[model samples]
Target: MELDYVVGQTLAWLRALGIEKDTFVFFTSDNGAARVSDVPVPGGGSNGPFLCGKETTFEGGMREPAVTWWPEHIPAGTVSQQLGTVMDLFSTSLSVAGFSVPDDRLIDGLDLSPVLHNNTLINRPIFYYRGNGIMAVRVGLYKAHYWTWSNSWEEFNQGINFCPGQEVAGVTTHTQQEHTMQPLIFHLGWGPWEKYPISAVTTEYQDALSRITAVVEKHKKGLVPGVPQLNMCDMTWLS
Candidate 1:
């Protein structure tokens, strides 16, 4: 695959430059793989065992495949299930470079050096946003879905149509509608295929929900009003 070739070259280049040990290379996709129905068959990408695929706030959409490379910094053959986001790169890179993040601004990213260096656990809740609105949040092993949508274009019925016994090929129709309702809770530790509601069954659900709700409230309090800017000068090439 092209991705494989590119990554191989990247590592090779880093090794040649003698900076592979010092450089931090994080390889990951922006979202999960495309569903089988969305792409052409014979080589259609799978979202693995996750519920849905790209373009939705499901675990499949938010949980992406990632690989971090830092030869001497990050331990080899070590895998961390730590919760992290792309936003953390800003602060993490700065920290690794020995620079301080600005104290005047709200930084949603926590320093991931500890997690990478010592395998520390990060219990922060990751708020999943679809555009300007918050769709869901995941803290620890629990995830709360406040909004719902099917991964593929076929919508809610796609699951039934694409299952093992009920497999239907080349079905593309927009029959699902966006939905808003009470939050649906899931414990990801239970496994990717377990989507059953366990809020009533587990006492930790309400406590975790309350903590996540507070996180949202604290985030709201940190919001700063935006000020529009305009360019007043024109630039010309200098002799």
Candidate 2:
């Protein structure tokens, strides 16, 4: 209700100022809902049919719906399945403002103007990173889990379970487990919830793995390590 009211008021203001057609509004979430146990509901929050919530590399943790609004420029009631990330906002805004993105540094974001304007599909792979480590990658309709870890156990010890009753064996784990040698591949088209993993002996598995491996190798070859920020801490209080 509050969100609806805020959006309504914002749009009303834009219309009042006669700038609604010129303004571009992009709505999205940083991550999936946090499902803790302290809330009034049995499960704190819902991530729909996806398994687990924020802090994991599962679909529930990262998959989010995005809404883009531009009066005459973007068609209304149109939906796009093109892959996009929050980072694209940077490039998209730059393109909209008649500015070019900096070319000196590596920019992982792609301009989403085509998708917004014509609902065109862009074929690109998305790499899911968790604290500087690549946990998963998705290309087209298939997703490969290179590493699997969930905080449900950690939260459960603290009286919460993010996954609740939807935990799948060998996919969700308490500790970080590497699947580099044999990544767990899932056809998101068939099961977006990631319940079924392709059998290693199957031809589909081989084809998917071959494509994923090539992308991963190319990514690693051009990767540049940055300073770690998550581990930084201040000890001034101890003095």
Clashing pairs in 1: none
Model 1 C-alpha lDDT versus the unseen true structure:
0.67
What TM value does model 1 have?
0.78
In candidate 1, what are the lDDT values of residues 131-193, reduced to their tens digit? 667777777887776665443444435543222221222111133333234466677888654
Q: Write the per-residue lDDT of candidate 2 for residues 83-194, one digit (tens) a residue.
A: 8899999998999878999999988788988888778888778999997789999999999998998864666688766677777888878778899999999999899998
What is the clash count of model 2? 0
Model 1, runs deviating above 4 Å: 151-181, 199-202, 225-239
- Every candidate's lDDT: 0.67, 0.86
Alpha-carbon shift of residue 167 in model 1 (angstroms): 12
